[model samples]
Target: MPTSRRYGDACPIARALDVVGERWALLVVRELLLGPLRFADLRRALPGASSNMLTDRLRELETNGVLVRRRPAAPAAATGYELTDTGRRLEPVLDALGAFGSTLPATGAHLSATSVLLYLRGSGRPRAAGTYRLELDDRVFTVRSHDGRVVVVPGEPGTADASLRTDPVTFNALLADPDALPGLVAGGSAAATGAVDRLLAG
Candidate 1:
């Protein structure tokens, strides 16, 4: 950002925007909510972000204490980024933003795996106790729901109690209209149907 760029306002909202209002800044935060992600993983998630732009955003966020950069311990040795306490506090904010955005008409754009993951985390509810394997084309993720909250982990777990396989578009549609789940192509144990039903009822 240019040094001259400024909202020049005293409002808290303006101050917050001053920190994260820049393009791709908040999206970076959104991506890190689930867990630490390597730089390459981040690049894959936000393909529109050029390397320089992404680097600047990460630097700014780190300087602002919204995130931390670290090297994974032993065996891994890869650099990754994760949110700080202040940054994690934005989870609810992003969730609310997502709920509000969903009401808007679709732009007919294709969503990336990371975007879909954010949507699931933003909108998911723990209506059943089990692991749900979500197969989005070739990408897979596991949804573990319990205690009235849902946790989404990357990749399929050893085994899933239920699984939902669909493309991003279909999944987004399902999120908007749970009744439309019948349109989804499903495959799993009968118990999986029950688990998914409970989730959709939300």
Candidate 2:
């Protein structure tokens, strides 16, 4: 988008939309929510986007101070893109969008690992203090719930009060039907089921 591509309005919402109104802009932000991502990783997460379009969107976001590109730390390392503090503020916006979009019918879209992780993080709202470990296939994430909120970080915790391990399909099922957890849990850990229930409760 050109520097002049804007709504030419004074409203805050319009100004904000002017910066991120283009196609694939916000989706790019969504992909980078958890952490920085190399160009290849971003392409993998957004298979439909062309290389030229991706580059243009990245440039636009960078120019707007929404994200920054980083150089490789190692000789063989790939350059990556990470959100700026201004960009990180979009977390709640993405969460609200995801929650609202969930009401729509399924499109059979392929959910990438990051997409699943984002959904889990967005859906989580723990009422009490606890540590819950979630394993999605080979990926492991530690979710710490305290003060009526939750923080999900990658990797297993040293000591977790509860844990849930399952593939993406089963995990989605568990979210859709909390009552079906007992049958969905591979190990039938009640603690894990309870943890999932609390974290994903509507």
Candidate 3:
């Protein structure tokens, strides 16, 4: 449990939560874990969160040394938020939380854009030095590893080795268990217009 500033038994978990346990804080960190994103992008990625609340959370995160805001170099006038090295270490914690969350029954059964981004970050299969474009129905995803960092663009064009096409619910289910893909496709719950099976094989 978290302890007051007064001298008391202060557990590390509690201490850590003190900095990030506030509503929307962790989710904000999750948004930037994969890469830097503009404030507008983060706002779009996290729907339902008010602009004021988001600003508060971002400020708290910065004050706690978990994230940083900076302006992009030449040719770009936009500012973006990025995770600090200390914040990057929280990736494993977030991954474990995701695995655990997958086990619970989904109440809303809706996948937010942030959830999709996190899924892509977590489910991505590391490939050899190469790039591939993924197409799913009308949506396209371009994946590449540049300078040791994975980059995923939602809409881009190129040939692809595999593509998984499914609605958000089916995609979430498949992410929880790759074996569920076939049933989702065969049962008409999902439509795979490309090599979706191969993509989920691993």
Candidate 4:
């Protein structure tokens, strides 16, 4: 059974924490923010979280209505996890948190796919303005940037001005330093062909 560690206080912030106060809870939410993910994929994305802890967090979050377990579809036949509407509401909060967290000193910790995508979404102010398809290790997403805002949607876009394919860490590296794109591309670790700087430039 999922346990609730309540604050016993009536404050909204306290109430919110009561549901997601446990360690690895928010990180799990972060992983699911982009799209649904199977257990193995979630585990790969959150390597530091133990299976038992992640399983517990998922269960608690599901019970609290932050996320829900998905049944397997015909072809895939693999169960997954996705955010509920209440869970999706946490995006702006997490976005604000991501922005605030970026100001602190560097942790030098490895960047996950969600972290990289969040960084690009929050900090990117691209000169380019069009849809760019990004294929990260976890899955596919479409990035559209215009003016100063960036929007990321799950799955392939109707059309893309360019495409970039790479793993999380390498993608993070290339995005953070666009100058490395050429070298990374030549090295075959990263591939991009389009106005990706619009999606990458922060």
Candidate 3 residue spans exceeding 4 A from truth? 1-9, 74-76, 120-131, 134-159, 163-170, 173-194
Go through the candidates in order and give each one's C-alpha lDDT.
0.75, 0.77, 0.67, 0.84
Q: Candidate 4: which pairs clash?
A: none
Cα lDDT tens digits, model 1, 86-115, are: 999888888888889889997746676667
How high is the lDDT of residue 97 in model 2? 85
Model 4 ranges with Cα > 4 A deviation = 1-4
Q: Clashes in model 3: which pairs?
A: none
Q: Compared with the true structure, what per-residue lDDT tens digits does model 2 show for residues 167-202?
A: 665666666677887664546532264555665553
- What are the per-model C-alpha RMSD values against the true structure? 4.4, 4.2, 6.2, 2.1
What is candidate 4's CA lDDT for residue 138? Answer: 47
TM-score against native, each model: 0.74, 0.74, 0.66, 0.90
Model 2 bad stretches (over 4 Å): 1-5, 124-129, 137-139, 162-169, 178-202
What lDDT tens digits, residue by residue, belong to model 4 across residues 1-202?
4545788999999999998888888989998888998888889888888898888999999989999998976875788999999999988888888888978988856667887888788774554678889999848899887777788878999789989999988887776588888888899998888777666664
How many collisions per candidate? 0, 0, 0, 0
Clashing pairs for predicted structure model 2, backbone only: none
Between candidates 2 and 3, the one scoring higher on TM-score is: 2
Using lDDT, rank the candidates from best to worst.
4, 2, 1, 3
